[model samples]
Target chain A: MRRGVLAVYQVLLLVLLFAAWHVLVKLEVLSAFFFGEPLQVLARIWEWFASGRIYPHLGITLLETLLAFVIGTLAGLVVGLWLALSDTASRLLDPYIKAVNSMPRVILAPIFAVWFGLGIWSKVVLGVTLVFFIVFFSVYHGVREVSPVLLANARMLGASKRQLLRHVYLPSATAWVFASLHAAVGMAFVGAVIGEYLGSAKGVGYLILQAEGVFDVNTVFAGVLVLTLCALVLDWIVTLAERRLLRWRPAGPGAAQS
Target chain B: MSPQPALALHRVSCRFDARGGGTYVAIEDVSLSVAEGEFVAIVGPTGCGKSTLLNVAAGLLAPTAGAVRVFGEPLLGLNRRAGYLFQTDALLPWRSVRDNVRLGLELRGETDADRLADDWLARVGLGGHGHKYPHELSGGMRKRVALAQTLALDPKMLLMDEPFSALDVQTRALMENELLALWSQDRKSVLFVTHDLEEAISLSDRVVVLSAGPASRPVGEFAIDLPRPRDVSEIRLQPRFVELEQTIWQALKREVLRTYQRAEA
Candidate 1:
């Protein structure tokens, strides 16, 4: 099938890329000190995994990402529904919401560190701050833009206010949230890594920081490689969840399909 | 015959705030009624506020003036005894066909919702498609699901706004025949609105024509004396049916021309 052929080409491309990188470094065309040797990076990753030294760091990062993504999405959904349904509230909060969303939210990591210390909570809070806005805007638009005909139809079917919220608002709102799942998850991962780099003794970001202090470029490359794999795992998990939850959507190049 | 009508809109006037400062009148001083178990179709020119009248009857829109009564009682909130069929796709895209059909009953706290939903799906000839989503089905099939969703509630009255206008000619005729078959079982008082004069004449016991808008009102009314168990495609070939169409088209044609002329001006 076409999909099978495409997969083979994808794997071939990755191999070609790695092979070219290995050959360039061995020929001294590229500086190993700056780029780091591909063999050493791969070996370093293998050693860390073989020794099981990277498990705690990887686990902590994933935990923070999960907690932040869940809390942020839930908060966004509830607040979005409230604002969309209440015209007065939305109008009153419009300017303030825009101002806060436009601010450089990553700058809050230092403040969070001061309040929550160098624990996991500070990183989680930073991740939550990053993930919240993406979900909030999506849900808000989704709820506000719900087809009026559907609302009228549900009303005609004897739907009470509570029933309307349960049957109509939540489902539509979640579609928008799910559509933006990738961006939110990526933001959470970035928040956790950045928060760790600023002030934390744990997580892969901390390991990379420690490696950089000693000019251990190979170790730094190894740490980044490990972190990249972890992100891939998280993204894969998100894709699985989106598939199960959004199966009703048409099959296309978006969420809600295989 | 019962003296009280099933639905009565008395001197209803709906005026909307225009884009600028002044008010725009949609339907002005329009009064209409549908007797119990009667099928009444309201035909009009484009933008003649035909849907505004239907929305008022359904209690989805409150008229700027006058009142709406249902079976002798003044409607306060949503008309609880009426089901609405919208012109556009109204089925919840996320829900399966059976779940969409069960939505109303579930909202009402009915315990046997699944059984009733399945039964209604069967009635609409979509029994095997209960597991499919709205987008997975054809346009006509989705409309059938919407019909099942509305009919499962078993409301005393039905308010349909050009429910079959979106389907193709063949599918539209098939849906019409199915609708007639369902309505004949126990004639629910129906207020069907459309711009298709042929569709209006074919499906209803009576047809009311509204003039072009700015302030639209009913300009004509005609009784359809076509016999029961009629096939919508076959009925158009009959001489009586043609005569009725010509008579109604005369009343409707001037309003249609007025709408076009105003648009060009």
Candidate 2:
């Protein structure tokens, strides 16, 4: 009953906040340029959509995020596996990898922009850098923690090196990969947004930057809402893929009902 | 009754590098052999290097001294003659029952994995559970899947490390019976490792007792001579089974004490 009441309360709070927001703008408690009326923000979104001003920028940002996510994930998987499998490589490069992972990667946006230009490539490189280390560490830890007893059993059963990788290492690493991807999605967005913020001439981030330059706080908030919506949608797709791939996971309440 | 030895270990010794200067011996001066189609069990206290010996036989571990051979070939370079059944079922949690059974066959590049896996799973009384994953099965069922997998390859030799130790008493008995029946179909040479004296006595043609570590060596070998088809119910009843169990226990008891003493030291 408490949960049900809380759910209703959440919706009521949202409505109340929007009402208060519109009232403040109408009463002149907030400036139109800085806060804007809620109705105006909604009107601007529809206007941008109808004029097709939003589509091209949205498309570019989406493409950059998707490409960077895939490239970063694949590169992380391969390198992580290689490092985990080789004792000498893991030992030699572990400290350097740790140092690089620990550093603030967002600070490299200007450097990436200079290297790859104000195009989508610079955003992709930045996104991949951010996503790669999180996934690499997860996959490496997953593979390393594989049960020795299982490995011994496989060896006794005549498993080849290739077979061991497929049967054991891959399955073990899969959980870690999924966990990393949830974080990676947000990082991908950050990479593209930061890239546009630093230099790009066109992107949702570019639109947000333009609005901010003119002190248009309402438009800045509008860009944030758009990005958040896109991230949630992408995260839903990833969750679906995870469900299909990891069916071996014990049936949850969802499966029980089905 | 004349055939080559299925496996032979000559003065096998395994040593691990310790944190200190001295070496830690897992096994030392251990010589053993199993004849073709014979079921031999090795019993020892914990830390007696029984697993180390099995690994050496499977060609996974290299002995610091001496050599292991399977079917007249040195185990050092051999790839696939031995089948190892771990203490845990070690079934791939992500795979279905049939897939777990098909794993070894798939690794060996056998194209007929589907049909073979079906047959083996049926043989283990898991005919309709082919699509169910390991997490969906019970402990005994998981071990059955592991057994079916090992048997699917038709290995020349089977090395089991406490394969039934994880099961409940009733399940263990049933598993032992299933194993005996499977062995009867085509008696592959088996080297089973266990700490259970009765288990070692109940299933083996011969039982080898080993001393406790840092350097465990064979203490004695007892040949089980009760009867053929080795009646599980009758074998327990036999005076010989109890005699062999007691004898092996007597050999193992001192080693168990020594192992504990060493730990405290």
Q: Model 1 segments beyond 4 Å from truth?
A: A255-258
**Residues A81-176, candidate 2, lDDT per residue (tens digit)?**
999999999999989998989989889999999999989999999999998988899999989999887787666666778889988899888867
Candidate 2 residue-wise lDDT, B1-265, digit = tens: 3366899899999999989888899999999999999999999998788888988887778889997877777876543777888887588778899988888788778899999999999999999999999988989999999999988999888999998888999998889989999999999999999998888888999999999887999999999886878757568878878777787788888888888998999
Q: Lowest summed lDDT over 10 consecutive residues: which window, candidate 2 chain B?
A: B73-82
Model 1 chain B poorest ten-residue lDDT run: B1-10
True contacts kept of each: 0.85, 0.69
TM-score for chain A as predicted in candidate 2: 0.88
Error of 2 at B197 (Å): 0.9
Q: What is residue B241's positional error in candidate 1, in angstroms? A: 1.2
Q: Between which residue pairs do clashes occur in model 2?
A: none
Candidate 2 Cα misplacement greater than 4 A, ranges: A1-43, A251-258, B231-234
Report the number of the highest-TM-score candidate. 1
lDDT of each: 0.91, 0.87
- Highest DockQ against the true fold, candidate: 1
* Chain B TM-score (each prediction, in order): 0.99, 0.96
Superposing all C-alpha atoms, what RMSD in Å does each candidate have to the true structure?
Answer: 1.5, 3.2
Error of 2 at A155 (Å): 3.6
